[model samples]
Target: MATQGRSTLDRRRFLGLSAAGAAALGLGMAGSAAAQTPSGASRMPPSIAALGPVLGKAVPIADDEYRARLAKAQRLLAEQGMDAVFIGAGTTLRYFVDLNWWGSERTAGVLLTRSGDPIYITPEFERSRAMEQVRFGSEIRTWQENQSPFDLIARTLRDRGIATGTLGIEEQLPFFMADGIGKAAPQLHLVSATPVTAGCRAVKSEAEIALLQIANDATLACYHAVWQALQPGMTQQDVQALVAQAYGRMGVRGFVDINVGKYTAQPHGSIEPQKIVEGTVVILDDGCQVHGYTSDITRTFVLGKASDKMKRVFSIVQQAQIAAREAARTGGMMGDIDAAARKVIADGGYGPGYKYFTHRLGHGIGMDMHEWYYAVGDSRQPILSNMTLSDEPGIYIPGEFGVRLEECMVTTPAGGRWFTPQSPSIELPFG
Candidate 1:
């Protein structure tokens, strides 16, 4: 589940340990004393306090990977019949050039031609800052404060011999930028860059998968620790605090949205104050990031014993998750995956499509929490190998409780494999 607000706990604020240092400290062992909560009323449990960083196996995307990504984008441009592609300062730019730039009123991005090096456009004053992060490109074009950056973009395209062909604009690029560029280059046609950007990003490389795996593993570990630490009378905020502390102990920044009792029925959660009690259902959603890659997992359980109805609902949701996973084979239609999960939920008595299963089966997951190629009944996109997605199936019953089981999965030649095992039961969520 996605939350509107996030409270991040920097790893450095707690352990501040390097990956090697964390490994030496030992995994599954308590490294330091528990820190007091912001209210100074409680200390974290031993399970959470014992958590240690698990990023030792994680490797950031290397320079070669960036170059290869650029190569793939260029190949996609050529195949799509576009002269050059404009990548604004965002994830798309980061994906190709390794430039972690923020977009503002001023324009800053890269222009990749069909046959030449990438041309970076930025304000004249920010050129030095852009230089620090441009790992793959060299030709930097600058526009003074009095000049128009769109004009600079048009001229750069002409300089690269792209006089009158189609130019693919990054889908997330601002409308003003696109409109300005269109007006500046009336001869060139502007089109969506999804065919090129999503074409390359939707597929995950082995290295990307490895990073995602570790991120998911770390999140599950944090969840397990937090679950062990749960107690009666803890507020929803307290549980969220525990989650942040667990990630802090693990030496990674993370966030979570805590939902209790009837509020759990709301997929994104509620802002009302909620207290945990015996037999009350609690749902923990969201996950941490490892090397800019994200992991999203949701676990629902009770602090004490679960009622019979809750168990039955949990089982149905679990089965739905499995059904969706089984249907996510390479070459299968993406819609089929959603249909498979919805069928299980409906057949289990929550029928008539979207009645209880409130949302789509899952969404594409990678650097961003929600990406391309979603798994919805109306989607007809083909599921391909190496595509990573979430297999989240939920049953929300208003004024009662909801059960959602989410796990990130990668599509393999064999089929879809989850980064972590599905929750066995409500009582034993991590299993």
Candidate 2:
């Protein structure tokens, strides 16, 4: 739909925040997150999948969408001049097969070519579900869990007469997986397939956008619920528990990694166990996931009233966020919008350089929280309609306090529309 709106913000207020600002609210950050572990791996914390139906269905790709996405991938293969694009990364596998199962013991992959039907190679244990989800492919090959899955993949290619052709491998392929594939198919020339896949997945389709909008609405609802659940003297952990409960009740299937901080204005500081005391500035950043789509939002609040310094930082950040959002348009350079936000932060005398603003203006959010098209100092990617990203800007004034306001935005035929509601202004009670 149409994606543009004027932000109605009041920026002239400089007052104290809630002197007794203590409550649990959902808050998150805008940076690189830890690499996700394969499903059931002990190295990483358990994912929502471990929570069973509490996180939702195991259906990743299903029915019509599955067929449509595969057809799209085949088209991309032709455009990239590759005979077969190897797909094994979590994002790629999720895109093609819709299975979220993971393991390092046996590598699972697919070979999508421009001419022939698609082929899947997975461990024998996963073969049944893979067969169920992989409806359009022409061949399904399963290797025993004890044997090399890459060997089966190589056999499939050989049996299909795919010799003397370039094999497109994902840039994100694990080193171990790549080594195994190299050993199995030494005759095939391997090249990076990121460009082909990136071109295919960068622009959101109407259906994808609709799913993201639903996720956004659910996210906003969760945020408001968490705010209402807050109370003075509540620990940060308590607030996090409330976020998980609220989001779960809303049908959001995701883990709740909530960060709550007071006086600690820097974005990455630990949310300690201290009681949220009076005159504290609280930042809540949280997200809710539906299917694989996720909505990220951030809001700064005062538990009771507004403090003088808190109000100033809040207003400046709100202004910056508005400016960045409004400037985002099709064909516009991403750097310019970021520069706009940085300029505002600097003009407010928050200092003239990177010292005050430590992070990028925004980042793309999709299948994974932070995906591509980041709005950073060096990035010059132009904004495109149908792309989705976060429009987050904040001024971190070390030790003293930090203020950041953020929302997810969807680029439309006309411009960009915010997915989540505009967070409240920086002042008492954060209303």
Give the candidate number with the greatest lDDT: 1
lDDT of 2 at 64: 78
List, residue by residue over 254-306, the lDDT tens digit for candidate 2.
Answer: 33333344444666445344556555777766465677776777777777677
Relative to the true structure, how large is the alpha-carbon lDDT of every model?
0.83, 0.64
True-structure lDDT of candidate 2:
0.64
Error of 2 at 142 (Å): 2.3
In the predicted model 1, the residue pairs found to clash are: none
Q: Each candidate's TM vs. the true structure? A: 0.92, 0.80
Q: Best by TM-score, which number?
A: 1
